[model samples]
Structures are given as C-alpha cells and as structure tokens.
Target chain A: MDKLTTVEGRAYPFGMKNVDTDIVIPAHWLKTISRSGLGQGAFEVLRKQPGNVFDDPAYAGSPILIAGDNFGCGSSREHAAWALADLGIKVVIAPSFSDIFSGNAFKNGILTVVLPQDAVDRLMEVAKTDPIHVDLEAQSVTTPFQDRFHFEIDPFRKQCLLGGLDEIGLTLGEADVIDSYEARQAQERPWIVPSAAPAVA
Target chain B: MVKPRTLYEKIWDAHVVERRPDGTCLIYIDRHLVHEVTSPQAFEGLRLAGRKVRRPDLTLAVPDHNLPTTPRRDAAGNRIPISDPQSAQQLAALERNAPEFGVRLIGDADPEQGIVHVVGPEQGFTLPGTTLVCGDSHTSSHGALGALAFGIGTSEVEHVLATQTLLLKQSKTMAVVVDGELAPGVTPKDVALAICGAIGTAGGTGHVMEYRGSVFRDMSIEGRLTVANMSIEAGARSGLFAPDDKTLAYLKGRPMAPAGADWDAAVAYWKTLVTDDGATFDKTVVIDAADIVPTVTWGTSPEDVVPITGVVPDPGSFEDASKQDAVRKSLDYMGLTAGQRMQDVAIEHIFIGSCTNSRIEDLRAAAALLKGRHVASGIKHAMVVPGSGLVKAQAEAEGLDRIFLDAGFEWREPGCSACLGMNPDKVPAGERCASTSNRNFMGRQGPGARTHLVSPAMAAAAAITGRLTDVRELMTTQKGMVA
Candidate 1:
C-alpha cells in the first residue's frame, strides 16, 4: 500500500443514509466463511430492482462510492466491507459512516472518506459524470472540474493503509515495545507468568 | 511519545501485539462468546480445514435465537413439540455443535440457559479489564461489567477460536457523564434513548464509551446492562460501567463463577481493572439526567427519538437533506404525520420481550400493569419471549403468565422472536408496534414494519390502550410492585 496522494477512480454514488450492513450484504450470504465472491452478493436486494443503482453501467466497476450521511448504521457486520472491497470499492465517501462499519472498512483497506453533508451532496452530483481523485497523502478529493475537498484520517491508519499493512503487520511493527513490556511484566507481575513449563503447544 | 492516556488508551496499549504501518493491531481476545446464527459458518470453516478449537476453556456457547417460548413440559410433565420449527432446528444445531467442540452450551431447556447477553453477566462470565468478543452486536452489553466487549464477524470468530486472539484496530475513547436525577417515571430505556438522541447516533464513533455520572452510579446492574446494550446503536464498540457492589452481588454464587477460595481472588483481580484517578479521555460529553424524558423512537434509527409526549419531527427540521427521504419513508410506512404527537398516536401491536428488556424485572413491571384489566380492543399484544427456560418457568410459578393472559395478551415461548424477524413472531408489514426490543431500523421487524422502542411497562400500557400511552398514568392508577 503506497501512500496515495490522489486516487483517480470511477465513482459510484448511492443516494440515502443509514444504508445498513444488511442492505450492503444480506444475511443469507453469510453462510460461507470465505470472504471471496462476496462482491456479487453486495447489495443483492437493491440489484434486484429494475434499473438499480449498483447495476447502472455508469457506476459499474467503479472503485469509489459517494454516499449520503449516516451510511452503514445497523448491525456490526464486517461482511459489508468484504463485499465492498470484493466489488472493487476502495474508497467510500459519505457525510459520515457508521462507526462499526468504518472500523470494518479501515481494517479491510477500504478508505472511509467523511466529508460534510454539503460536500457529499456536491460529490454525489459530480459523481454522475466523472472519476474522482482522492489523495491520501494530501487528505483531499479533487475533480476534473477543479472542485477540491479536504478530510481527515487517523495518521496511524493512513500510514497503515498506504503501506498495505494489516493487524499482523501492525503487531510486528511494534515488536520492540511488546518485548520490552513483557520483560517488565515478568519482573513486576511474576505470578502472571506461569512457573510451570509452558503448556503443550 | 508519552504513554497513551485514558482507559481506552491503556486497554489498547495492553492488548497490542504489534502495529503495522497500516493502523490495525494484532490484539488478543481474552474471552469469546458464540451463538447459533453466527457460529454455523465458523464451524463449517473448521471442518473444512480440519482444525480444532484452540482454547475451549476460554470460549462459551449458548442458544437463545431458536429456543421455543413455550413451556417444555405439560401438566403430566412430558416433553412437547416446539411451536416453531425454525427455532427448534436452530437450537438443535447449537446443542449439537457445542458438544462437538467441547465448549459449554447453556441449552434452551437448561436452567442456566437464557439470552446470551443476559446469561453472560448473570453467570459471572464477563470480567473487568478483559477483551471479550461475541459474534453478536449486542455483545457490547457485557461492557456494563467493565469489560471491553465487542462484536466480531464469522471469520474473526474462527480466528479467535483457532488462536484465542483477534486481529484488530484500536478505537478512540469517549466519556459520557450524566448529572442530576432521573424523573420519577423515567427508566433506563429513556436514559439510553435520550443519549442516542442527543448524540445524533454517530457521535460516539471510533470510541468505546465510559459512562460516568451520578445517574449511572445509582442505576442497578440490570439498568446498566440496558444502557450498555444500546451502545452499538450510538456507534460505540462498547459502554462501560465501573463495577461496584451491585455487580459483585449479581455475580455471586453463579454456577460458572469461581467458588469458595477462588472468589476472593477473583474479586481482587476485578478490583484492579478500574481506571486510576486522573485518567484522561479523548472526548467528553456531559448531560443532565433531569432533562431526559421518557423517550420513544419516532423513526427507524435509534437517533430518531424524542420525549414520549413529543410528536414526530417534521422532515424540514433535519439539517441534512439526505435524512429527508428516510423521514418521509418512515412516516409513510408508520402512518404517522410529521406533527403527530407520539402520545396521541394509536398503535396496533405491543411487543414486550427481547434481549434488551426481557428479564424478571421487566416481566414483573408489565405484569403489574395487567394485574386486573384487559388489553384494549383492536390491540394485539403479547409478552412472547424471555431469555431462558428458567425464566418462563419462574414467571408461570409466580402467575405472571396468567396475569398477562388474563389481560388479553398472549403468553408465548422464549426466543429472539420479533426482535429481528428471524422467526415466526414478526409484526405484519405497515403495522405500528410499541416494542421492547433493541433495534428500530427500518424493516428490522419485518418488511415495512414500524417499531418504537420503550420500556416493558410502557409497552404494556400501549397494549392496554391500543395507542402510545405512558406507563406512569397506569402505575398511578394501580398499586403493589412495579419492579
């Protein structure tokens, strides 16, 4: 994951708020443990309607989604992110995403871009015609029409996503800290460290 | 930099195994709780990979979703067929799966059996200063006991089962302090709803909340559980209440809890989990509990709440244009006008049971309301479920079931019925119901169903009036225990 100053990609704008995880991916699709092939299952209900948004040729294969406020406000289902990532949605721009959904998105390497409602409204309007460029390094989304918007991301998360690091990567990065802490704990809370031989592997 | 500050900071620091250039950490899960709906796939994954549960002792399983609400025995004490096949099968799967994995299962018919959320605390499984994970969102309910309890996905569930740990990112910390006293009639449901309304649903984003206030201090363990249970709705991963005597009393002598000599040791461990004085937090919000009114949600989201007497909000009042469509949709589906007073609105159904409000206390409160009078005509009402077989049996022995039935309400078997539309007890589409369940999101009950969250007593009043009515009025009209 290289630092992305700007990501110019096709846009998929969904209209409305509180677009819950159930709507993102239905419970029926949860029968499998594998995260693969979930993209097809994403928004299956919406895709069922005639002239559905996700199926629109204009937004097809788009990796960016501009959405309304209060997006993703139901259950804490991580499948929502899995489906989005599987469908090539690398960035989700909304007035605000549900906290659980945002955490899930971040872990799965989907950039949850939060802008003001007005900004989101404008983006939704602009998304109909052209690709949007998101620069993680600059913390901004820019358009061909010269529209520019700035948003904030946790500096640490930005570093992780830019470097394509997952939780395992994060842990190893702080190996020195963990090792030192363990050593200190061994001295202070010796009882916590079992005196018996380590249990069977 | 200086050591991370705040309880969330300390917790995150303690759990972190490493941090990648990306922001997530490899955090260890101290405890894992599982249920039927989310476990099947994880079990399948293990079967496919020929793997075993890594630390069976740390994992616990329970059946709540598919358990029959009906009594398990008849007058002659014989087993009976469950009224709902789906629930029966779901419980059967849990019963079969738990034994296979060598994990404890509190079966539907087991006295220890109950809603996973309720049983965890009641059995003393939830401990302070631990990272607890469940496959259900309401896992946040456990945080009332001071643990960092949160939900996980099936893959994460399998990950925890295989390694007793979960890969995760840390969350920010939010502190909510409520001052002043609650009004006489206000309940924990109202307090939680008030918080949700004030916070606008997403205010607690990227944070685990520590509830600190006089109101929280005075609240019972049950009340704290109700408040913490809805933390996810406010977009917080968990809500914590500092453990006190109430918590200890609740956990004492439970079957799974440490016995005799170990009890003191366990208490000593729990005492050390609290935050020290002068701890700092990332954000803090303060509210006066006296300002809160008995609350009910007017729309699908938990954020769409107001004082009980207040009317549905006009869509124009919403600043975000995006919310307008949802307001209109919810109003259309609920058959409500923008200015319609919630108290003046008529309701067709009242559901008085769910993991959120189903307990001995909730049942007693509703039963007190229906002691003598019958439910209003045109109102279909029921206390269709409880958390466990023991709860149902105890309710019957105490004649609470008879009181409910006498009031023209159906007394049915226990399950997560009508809460999430996972079974047969769903409200019909387009019907308005006063429910005691947690989520009120659009179509959460069923296709096009309208739901309003309320306390059990409030739900009972609605049942008796065929409309949204306050419980205080009825409580004043009657006497004896209201729990």
Candidate 2:
C-alpha cells in the first residue's frame, strides 16, 4: 500500500452508470497471475471505439476518474482496481460504488470518492480542460473554478490510506489475541473448526 | 432479556474476535472458498512475504474459471492437457499453491471440483451460523443455507489466508419480506428478477438482505439458493435465509457436515440462528408474490428487467435523462427496439448453467421443459453446463442428460462455462443468448455478445422456440427450482 493524501490531475470523464468490473478489465485479461501490465487491458473494450476517453491523448496518464452511480458494480475481481491503478488513476469520483469494488480500491491504494450526482457532473465537465484536486485529509474534492464538494469515508479506512498501513502485518502482530480467540472457539464452538488435518500435496 | 438481535446480528456477533471504537471488527471466517482466477495472486503474495496460511484446513481451492467444460479425459483414460498456455499456467499455480499451503485443492480432474459457490455447500463446507468468504461474487449463494458469506478481493483473500479473520465494518440489515403464493411458472429466478426491478441495481448497496415471510418460508433450499445467488446482482453484499428444517435436511448427511453428537449440536445451534420475534431491520422491502411474473432482463443490467408478457421498455419513458441515456445505449447494444414484444426477441444461444442456477434442481427444471422438445432449428448453440462434476454425474444418473441431448442441447462437464466465458464456451460476437446466469452485464458472456438473464425453464423455453417465450405456455407441471 502507498500513502495517498492529495491527488491532483486531469480525470477520465467516464460517466457511465452501472460500470461493472467486466468493462473495467474484461475476463480474458484475468489469466495473468501478476498484477502489472494491466494498464494495456484497462477499458480495453471501450478503447476499441474511436475517440473514446481512454484512447484520447488529451487524457492520457490522468490520475483521476469521474464516473456515474454504481460504478464497478459487478464481480469481486481486484483486477478492476489493479487496472485502474496501472492506468494511473489515483482517485475515482462517483455517485456510488459497489461494496466489493470499493474495498478493492481501498486495498490497492486507489481513492474512491463518493459525491452527489450533481457534484460528479460538475467535475466531469471540469475534467475536460482542467485538473481536479482531491484532499483526503479534508475529505473534499475541488476544481480550479472554486467548486468544492465534501465526501464521507470510513475513518478507519481514511487512517489506513493516509498511513499506507499493511493490514496483514498489523493483524499478524496481534497473534496472541488471535490465538486466545481461537482457544475460546476451540472449547465452545468445536464444530466450527474442522477436525481433519490440513491437506498437503 | 438481551436486546433482540436480527439473524445477521447473531451470526455477526458470534464471529467477532475484537471490535475497535471506530466500528472496525476483526471477524473470524469459518470457511474460505478459492478458485484459480483470484487465488493465484493471493498465493503469490504469501509466497513473496513468506506468510503461511494460519488455518489451512479452513480454506478450499479448485480450478473452475479457466478450466474447460469440455471432457477432462480421453478414451485411454489419460487427462487431456489444456491447449491455452495462459489458462494452463493459471490452473497449475493453484495446483502447486493449494497443497503447498496445506489447503485442499479439488484438482482439474477431480470429480468433486466445480464452481466455488456450488462446491462449498454441496461438500458441507458452508454451514449455518458461521461466516464464509470467497473471492467469487456468487459466494452469496452459500448464504441461502444461512451462512454469512460475501465476496472479497485478492488482497483480502491474502489477508484471510494469513489470519483467517477480516477487518470488516458491519453491514446494515435489510428484511425482504414476501407474502402470497407465487403464481405457477414463477420460479425463484422470477422472484429474484422482480426484486431487482423493484429495487434497482444498487438498492441494497451496503446492506445484507435477510429473506423473510411466507414466500421464502415455504421455499425449498434450492429455491432459496437461487434467490440468494442473485443477491449480488441486486447490489447486496450478501443475502440470507434463516436456517430451518429444510436447511438441516439439505446438509444432514453431507461429507463435511458434522455427524453423530456433533450433528445434533450443530442442528441445535442452527435452530437458534433465526431472527427472534420483534427483531428490527434497518430497512424493509415488502413484496407481493402474486405480482411476480416470468421475468427476464431485456437490457444489460439485472435491473433492466421486464415481465415475459411485457414489451422492451422505451428509454424515453424514463423521466431521468441519464437513465434514459443508459437505457438507449443498452437497447442499441442489445439490438432491440423500444416497444418490441419480449417474446419476439429471438435468441441465438442458450446457456442453462452458472453458479447462480446450475444445481440439480435447476437441471431438473430444464429437463422437464426439454423432455420431448428440441432446440429450434434457428437456435445456433445451446448448452447445459452443470455446476460441478458431481452435479453432472447426478444429472446423468437421473437421465436428465439424455433429455437435454435429445432436445438438441449440448451436455457438458461442470465448471463456470459460458457464464463468464473465460474458457472455450464463449458466445460469439453479435449473438443474443438467453442465460440462466446472474449478470446481464455488457460483454459478460463475451465481447459484443448480448445476454438476457432468465430462469432455467425459461432458457429451455427460449431454446425450443428460438426466442424468449413465456415458460408458462410450455409448463404442464410446476418445475420450480432454486439454483
């Protein structure tokens, strides 16, 4: 995870509602075990259309994306987030997002900003010519023309993003706590824990 | 008495190891289902970080997404190799990773291997009053059996593999109550589609829906599974039905379920997993079962739904300009005209399987409709891919395969064939398909391949007519099922 505090850049004005993961990164690109090189496949289908935003040189390497409601609405594939990150999208502003995609974005160090549709529309318009500013500490998105919109995010997620916390490392440090919990379950909820030994090749 | 808790609260609270002041809870996961597509990266992360799985026995891995639904063996009984180099490497990664991490792998040639969601409950790995997680979105299907299951990404997959616990914020509970009897020919798929239409795609975005009332109570386990499987499509992270006698009956003798005194104790605990009387939900959606018809999605999203007797909706009818734009794009991509009769929408392909509805009950429903009928001459391709090898075997034993084959449908091996089209079963470009899968997302079946979501019986009906027809017209008996 990388620290994300302030992201300022041109945004891809993809205002399509219900933009699912399949559209972000199609199923064929999922064969790769590694996460890199997905930038080439990001929005592959939409890029096929002439004059599409992703293919337009004007918005190339844009670190921000403006989308409509229910963005990333299908599949639990993290490839969507990976592709967005690989495409240099550091922030996504949408009216709403599917839960899985939101979590995936947070994990991949991409910021998902939720604002009202009106706010998103304004940003989408400004994205064509000017860079947008997103301040995580302020929980707000601002445009060059002084348009400011506030957003809400989970405080814990905000902290993790600001600090670039490695969640597994932090959780693993509490091994004793986890062991105690397991011990309690071993006594009270034995059926929940499998009795069979772990399998090996 | 303690404050009355909803079914979700009971299950959620029981799994909480710790709760932070910020409402972040470290919740224990009783089960983790993995597939080749998602687990490879997670396992690679572990290997790089030198982090071993904390509880390997709690995890199960299998190859489904990239594996071909074609035959697994040859006449000499030797396993056939995957021709696609990329897909073979993906499967090989899982084969190496699963056992190396001490996690069970239902390998490519294993008869027990199938889609993660279908394999979980069938093997009794998914249980009531426990928390389950998977990398696949349809893991919500296991929630039909009363498990608290939801999908996670590869990053979270690695987290769970290392700690067997997730740092999650509790989701608000929503009660989806249905009353009245479902009319004949209205299967759980119809009810699910109706629910999606009623509550748009993002209706339950941050909520876990608990299906309730008489309609769900009288429903079979398979039926509940069908509805639960589509919970993600309805924009809910998970959907649940309280464990009842039906749930117990479904799991009583499954291999992974407890036996003897353990089974008795498990059932006793499951009995207590229901919502208590007078419990409250954060949101409530009341549905009339009688109002549901044989429904199908006419456009891309699951929310773009209409009854069988209805016409393709005009995007201009929507008051919201953006919604109208979305609908227009969908109509154009689907090659449909506004006000066109849904029954007249011809289908070139028919797919009757996915994690959503590939169970035995789903197969039976299709077989009942296809017994003496045949796929229409104009229908180019039709396939029935069972959820797993076991499901395929069971269908073969019941002679359902004969019915499908006789009806001009291809009977295929289990795995998520054309549902996601990650394998060789992709629908061709510019073709229309009547699918029993959950999503009708753009390019979900294939790039430029239009997919219309429907029930198994309805899909079979479409195959017979070469168009989207009302399953009721062909139904001589109720073949209601949940998949």
Candidate 3:
C-alpha cells in the first residue's frame, strides 16, 4: 500500500445519497476471485444511464469522489471499496458513511473524509467544473474556487493511512506481545486449543 | 466502587488481547465463518504474502450465497445437475483452497451445508461469550447467542485468517429496551423493523446494541436470532440478547457443543455474562412492544418501513430537504404512489427464506398459516427455501413441506435463495416480491426487482392474497372460517 498524504484531482461529483454496495459493484461481478478489473464493473447500472458522470471523459481517472450523505450504506462487500480504488478514487467526501464501508475504505488506503452536508454540496458544485484537493495531513478539503472545508478523522486511522500500515502490519508489529499472551492462554486453557497436527497435508 | 458493566462492555473487556495507546484494541477472535463470495481474494492475499492460516480449526468455510436451492439430485438420490459456471467456479475455488489452507469446507453436498449464519448456531459452533467474524454483514446473526459477532471486510477477514485477531476501535454501546408483550401477530421481525423505522437507518451507526427488557427476555432463541440478524440493517455493528436457559437448551447436545461436564462448567460461566444492574450505556432507547404492528419496508433502505396497514408516505411529509429528496427517489424506484394502501399493493412474487427467517421454526410458522390455504391466482411465483439441509429434513419430517407444496408454493432446498440475486432463484426484473429477507435494497432480489421485507406469516399471507395482506387479518379470517 502506498502512503496517502494528499489527493488532488478532478472528482466525480456524483452526490447521490445512500448509494449502496449493490450499485457500486453488482453481485454478478462478485463471482470473480480477483480484485482487479473491478473498475470495469464499478457502477455498472448507473453507467448505463445517458450521460452519467462516471462515463464522462471530463472526470476520467479522477482521484476523488464527492458524494451525498450515508454513502456505501449496504452490504459489507469490500468490493465496493475495491471498485472505488480501482476506478482511481482515492478520497470520498461524504456527510456520513456506513461504519463497515468506512472501515473497508480505510483498510484499502481510500480516504473517507467526513464533511458537513453543506460542504459536500459545495464540493459537488466545484467538482463539476474544476478539480478538488484533499490534504490528509491538514485534515481539510479545498476546491479550486477557494472554498476550504475542514474534516475530522480518527487520529489512529489517519496515522495508519499516512504510514501505509494495514492490520497485518500492525499485528505483526506486536508479534512479541501476541506470542507471550498466546503462550499464557495456552497454559491456562488447554481445552480451548485443538490438538491437531500443526500442518495439514 | 467499580462501575457496573453493561453486557457489551463485559464481553468486550474479556476479549481484549492488547490495548493500544490510541484507544484501539487488538481483540482475539474465537471463530471465523467464511463463504465463497467475499473470501477468495483474502485467501489469495495470504498466498501472495506467503502466510499460513494461524488457526484453521477456528475457521469454517461454506458456499451459500451462490448455491442453487433447487435440488440437484435425481430420483435415485444421485447428484445430477450443477450450479452455474461462475458460481460453480467460486465453489471449486473454495474446495481447492480449503484443504491446502487447512480450513474446514462444508461443500454443497454436505448435509451441514447451509447459510453460514444458520449453520453456525445449529451445529453449536457459535457459543456464548465468544467473538466471531465473517466477511458477510449478516454475521451479526450469531450475536443472538450472546457472542460479540459482527461483519468484517476482506482485509479484516484475511487478518483473522492469518492471526486470530482484529485491530478494532471499541464501538459505543446502545441499549434498545423493548418492554411489554407484543401484539398478537407481531413477530420479532416486526419488532426489529419497527425499531429501524423509529431510529432511522443511521441511528445505530458506530454502536453495538444490547436488546433488553421484558420483550427480549421472553423471546424464543429463534425469534431472538431474527431480531439480531437485522442489527446490521440499522447500521449497528451488532445486536445481542444475553444468553439464557433457552440459549443453553438450544445448544445442548449439538455436535460441536461441550460434553456433559464441560457443558455444566460452560453454563456456569455463561450465567455470569449478564449486564450488571445499573450499568449505564452510551445511549438508551425504550419502546413499547404493544405499539408495534406487523411491519414492512416500503423503500430501498430498511428504515423506510411502516405498519402493513399504513399508506405509502408522501415525500412532502418530510421536513428535511435531503430526507424528502431521498423519499421521492425511493418512491420513484419502487413505482409506488403516495397515500396508496400497502395492503392494496399487488405483488408478483413471494420469497420466504433468507438468513433472516429460514429456520425450521420459520417454516413451521409460514406453514401453519398456509396449511389449508392456496396461493392467489394472480401470483406468478412463490417459493419456500429452508435455511439448511438439517432444517429442510426437519421441516419435511413435520410435513411442512407437503403443506407448502399443497398451497402452490415450491418447496426448495436450503441456501440463501432470493435474498440476493447471487443464485438462480430471483424475483425477475420489474417484479414486486413480498420477501422474508432482511434487505429490501433496490436490485437486492434482482435487477429492478422491488422487495417488501416481511415476516414469514406475512409472506405466506401475501402469497395467498397476491398483495401485502396483514397476517392478523388472515388469522381472523381463518378463525371465522373455522367458526
């Protein structure tokens, strides 16, 4: 994972509210094992409509998405986050987000910036004609039109995102502590530990 | 004196492996349930990183989302047909990965094969005082038995697979106390939907809800499971009802449960797992169960629900502009008019199965309503899918299958059928379905398919009337016929 500090690019200003995981990537696309190539399936239903912003050449390869309140409000399919990442969306500015989707987005290095609904509305307007900027270090989003909006994220998540530290990296970082705890647990509760062979052939 | 602890805090404190300076905790997981759709990439990530599963015994895998509910066996009891190529490929991937990775895989042919949530409880893999995770959001279903179970994304799934732990921030606890007894015909599903309607979908965000008070205390384990299953629908991390005698009796003598002596010790420990009296929660909501009616979701979100006797609400009735806009959009998508009676809304399909309401008890409830009735003439399709093979066999033994078949409803094999369109059983495009599933999101059943989430009896009533008829009305009519 690459460290994320600032995401500055034209944003697809699709401020559709309650855009669920089903719309992000349909269940049909979930059949494939690979996470790659999801960009093609991202917003499959919406892209079929005439002149949808996702298909417009103006915002092609945008690094940010301006969305309405309660974005990603459906299934816990990480494919929603994967599809957004594959489509080159690095930052999603929304009034609110579903907790599970926000977790998925953070884990995938996508910055889910929580802004006021008014701020998101302004960004949606600016994004139609100009690029927007998001600075994770400063915890702020700014448009080319001099509209600056501040946001707040959990300090721990911000650090993890800036450091490119995933859960695996974090767990492995505390390996010694985990090992000691496990040893104590095994000694205390032998019944919970299965006596299977270490490796199954 | 030490502060009294809520059930959420007690369970959460017990599972903490390590606490970080930033207030996040590394919680050890007791179980991990896996399915075909969301886990393939996580396993692939493991292979790419050259990591082995840290605790394969703690993980259980099954193929449910895409498994066909239609029986594939011939008259001679031999396997004849197969799933679609893509679904079959995903199942094949699970089969190929499970043995090599040392995880237990329950294939479609296995009698234990079912919706992961249903299988976990029935097989006694989900016990009290445990923390469980799965890639699917409905994993909250396990929390009904007093476990701290919730959904995780693929990355967290991989993290759990590699190390039986998750790096998580502690969620605030909310107490949802439903007092008084429910009205006659109002099931736990109605209670859950009524709560969602009261709080809105985002009300429980960033919180784990502990359902308490007299209503939850008196609810059967199956009913508790239904209520807990929809916790995610309210945007809560998970919902739990503390384990009791019913929970223990439900688990006793199951395949994976502890033996005689161990069972007594486990029960002793579980007895101490309740919330201490006077424990303060971050938030508390009290509802009168008598106020709840037979409920149904009328829009895309689960919170867009109303009593079955109510009319579709006008967007103009909402004060907030955004909420008004959302209501209008949802109404447009659902092809409904304001002031239209929900009972008058005709439906083309009826699906009575999901992780939500597909257990043997659910089947019996629906069958009890449909035993001497027939599906309406105008209905195009009606199906009853059991939750698991065990549940299916039990339903067959009780003659529920014959009752459904006699009522013009197709009695199908067990899987997550018509809940999401991952399988062949789906409400066709532009069709309206009265479903017993949790989610009623657009395209959840199929593309352009509109779903009205209902209880099993309500779904059976809809099947018999070709409309969203209130189950209580049907009950009264049946009594009158008997008189």
| Model 1 vs truth, CA RMSD | 5.2
Q: How high is the TM-score of chain A in model 1? A: 0.84
- Residue A58 C-alpha lDDT in model 3: 98
Interface Cα RMSD, each model: 7.0, 2.4, 4.0
Error of 1 at B362 (Å): 1.3
Clashing pairs in 3: none
**Ranking according to DockQ, highest score first:** 2, 3, 1
Q: List candidate 2 segments past 4 Å from native.
A: A195-201, B476-483
The residue-by-residue lDDT of candidate 3 on B176-207, one tens digit each, is: 99999998899989998998898877888889
| Docking quality tier of model 1 | incorrect
Q: Judged by DockQ, which candidate is best?
A: 2
Model 1 lDDT, residue B96, Cα: 80
lDDT of each prediction vs. the true structure? 0.75, 0.91, 0.87
Candidate 2 per-residue lDDT over residues A1-201, each given as its tens digit: 999999998898889888999999999999999988898989888888888999888999999999989999889999999999999888999999999999999999998999998899899899999999999999999988999999999998898899999999999998888898899988877888654432222
Model 2 DockQ (Cα-based): 0.60
